[model samples]
Target: MSGERRESGDVRGILHPGEQARHRRLTRLTVGPALSAFADRYWVVRWDLRGRPAYRAEVLSFPCVNVTFERSDLRTGGFVNGVCTTKYVRELSGEGETFGIRFTPGGFGAFTGMDVGVLRDDSAPLAEVLPAAAGLAERVLAEPSDERRCGLIEEFFAGRGRAGDPHFALVSRIVTAMAEDPDLTRVDQVTARFGVPVRTLQRLFRRYVGAGPKWVLCRFRLQDAADRLARGDRVDLAELATDLGYFDQAHFTREFTAEIGMAPSEYARAASPGQSVAR
Candidate 1:
C-alpha cells in the first residue's frame, strides 16, 4: 500500500497518485474491527472506495479483498478473496468503486476458525468464503453498530470453537501492549509484563503471529513513528531511539532499515516534505 490520505467527515479515505495526475481514491465506509474483549482477533471494518482514473497496488497479503459490484466490457466486477502473506502488487484502473474488509492476523482465525498461519501462504483464494463474509459486511455497514458487528465476529469464532486458542490469548496481550507504548516496549518488556520467559514468548509469537516477537515490536514501533511523521510531526531520531528503548541512534537506524528497507535519514527524507538532512 502507498501513503494514506485521510478523507473528510465521519468517513476515512486514501488517495494514491500514479505516474500521471491520475489517482486512485479509496473512500472507507465503516472500516473497523474495533478492539473488543475477544482474544487475539481484530477486524478492519468494511470500506467503500472509488478509484479515480487508474492505479495499482502490490498485494502484500490476502487478508483483504476487492469486491466489485459493477463492471463494463472495459472493466470488471467481483470480489478478490483469500488470505495471503506473500507480496503481490497489481495495477488497478477504472472509476466507480465499492467497499472491502480486512481480517487482522488472528482476526481471520476468529472469522474462519482456521489456524492464523493458514494465511501465510499467498496462494489460498478466499473467494470460496465471500458470500457469508460479504453478507456480514453489508449488514454492519448499513447499521453502523459496533455491538452488532462484534456479535457477528464472535458468532463466527463460536462456530469455529476457536475461542480457546492458546495462541490467540498470547498474541492479544502482546498486541495490546504494543498499542499502549510502541516506543517503550520490547520482547523482554513484554515477557516481564506477561510473566513469561523469553523463550515462551518467542514460541507464542511464532505459533500465532507468524513472526518473532522482536520483529513484531519493531514493525509496530516503526509504523507508529511513520504515522507520526506522515501527519507532520517534527521528530528527533536520536531522541526517538532513546525514548523507544533503543541503545542509540546507530542501533535504531540499523533496525529501521532492516524492516523498512531504508535507512532512518533516507526514510525521513522520503517521508517528510521539508525536513532538513540529518546531521
Candidate 2:
C-alpha cells in the first residue's frame, strides 16, 4: 500500500523529477520579509539543450500567480501568469534563462486592487499590469547574475510605494493551512478552522486566489499524489484515494485521469527509469 502522504510534504510539483536534472537547473530563492506580503519567492531556471533533443518540462502548479522574465532563443519577454488550474507544460531547447516571481495567492490582488479571477488560466505582458515595469524586463534579462536580477525585481516591487494589504496576511495564513493540513478536505472544514463564514471565504478567494478554496485543497492533494507516484513509490490506489478524501477509488481515478491526463498506474510506469515520459 502507498504510505500516507500529507499536503505539507515537500512536493516541488515537477511531474518528471527524475528527468529534470538531465536538461535544466532550477533554483528557488527565499522571499525576503520586506516583500513577503506581496511575493512568495524568486526562481531561476537555466537550461542548455544544444545538440540534444528538446525536453518537455511539466509542472503541477500551485494556486498562485507568477511573473516571469525569460530570455531564450525562441522567446524573450516578461509575462504575468495567472493561476493555471491545470497542469503546466513547456518545451526547452537551445540555451536560455528565466527569472520568475511567484506571488502569494492573495498577493497579486493587493497590488492592482482588481479581482484576480479575471486572470485565471490566462497570462498578460508584464507591461500591461505594471506600466512602470515596461522597461524592467529588458534590464532583468540583460543581467547575467541571478542575485542581481532578483534585486532588480525586488526593487521594482518595493518601490511601488503601495501599502501592505491586511487581507494578504489573512489569505496567506488560510492558504498555508490548506496546503499543510491533509484533513482539510472539505470547505466546511476550512470555515470551521478559520472561523470565516462560507460566503466570505468564497468571496475572498474569488477576488484574490482566482479559484475556490475547494479547488486549492484538491489541487494540493493531487500534487502530493503526483509527486509520490512520479517517484516510483509503490502505492495502493484505494488507500491513496482514502487519504485524499475521495469517496472511493473510482472517484479518485476519474478525477486524477481528468486532471493529469493519464491513469495513476500509467503515470507510475511512465516515470520508471528508461521510460521516455514527455508531458
Candidate 3:
C-alpha cells in the first residue's frame, strides 16, 4: 500500500518525509461516529525492509494516548502508549504491520478514571490499561482487511457509550483551543479565554491529558516550527520566534534543538529533497 500523505492538521512530528518512501506506508482513517468522542483517528503503518537497513522514524508526540495492535517478525501484541513528554522513535525492519488508535487529548481519561499523569513516558499492555480490550490485539491482527479492523475497534468502544462526564468535554475544548490559537502563548491566556482558573486548568490537564498546559502549548508551537522548516519555507527566525511567544530567537533555538535533535536551520536543509540527515 502506498503511504497516504497527511490530509489535514499539522504534519510536523513525523520526521524525514523524504525517507518514508524507502521504508514504509502510513494510512490514517477516521473513527466511526459512535467512537468519535473518544478517538481522534485510526492509523495503519506497514513496512517491509527485507535485506535493507532498518529505518528509524522519529516523532514529536501530542498530548494523547495510543493503543496499538502490531504484528511483525519482531513481535505481535497490543500495547497502550501514554502521552509522551519527549521525542518518540520507532525502528522499522524486516516486515511488519500495525493498527493504532490515537485517543483525543484527555479522551482516554473518560474511559478509565486513573490519573493520566501516572502513565506519562510509559507504556503497558492493553489489557492492563483497559481490561475490556483483552484479546483485541489478536482479533485485530488476524483481520486482513483494514476496514474490518476499524469495525472491530468501533464495536469495542461503541458498546461503552458516550462519555458523560462534563469535565472531559471541557478538557477537549480547552485543548483544542490551545492547538488552534497561535496567539495563545501563555497559560494565562488560556485561563482568561476559557474562564478556567490557573490551578484548575493545570489539575484538569494532569488528570486527563497527562501533561501540564504549559508543556502542551510549547509542544504545539514547536511542532508548527518544525513543519514550516521541513517544508523548506524561507522563514525569518526572529519573527517566527516572536510569533511563537518566545522571548527571543536564541531561546527558541535552544529549545528546538534540544527537543528535535537538530537546530532549525539544519532541519530545514535536511528536509530539502535529496539532502540527507544524520540522525
Q: What is the lDDT of residue 54 in candidate 1?
A: 40
TM-score of 1: 0.60
Question: Cα RMSD (Å) between model 2 and the true structure?
Answer: 5.9
Largest TM-score belongs to which candidate?
3
Residues 52-102, model 2: lDDT tens digits: 999888888888889999988767899988999988888899999888888
lDDT by residue for model 3 (21-79), tens: 45787778878776688887888889989999988888889899888999887668998
* Models, CA RMSD each: 7.3, 5.9, 3.4
Which regions in candidate 3 have their CA more than 4 angstroms from the true location? 1-10, 273-279
TM-score of each: 0.60, 0.89, 0.92
Candidates 1 and 2: which is better by lDDT? 2
Q: Count backbone clashes in candidate 2.
A: 1
Candidate 3 lDDT at 4 equals 40
Clash number for each model: 12, 1, 0
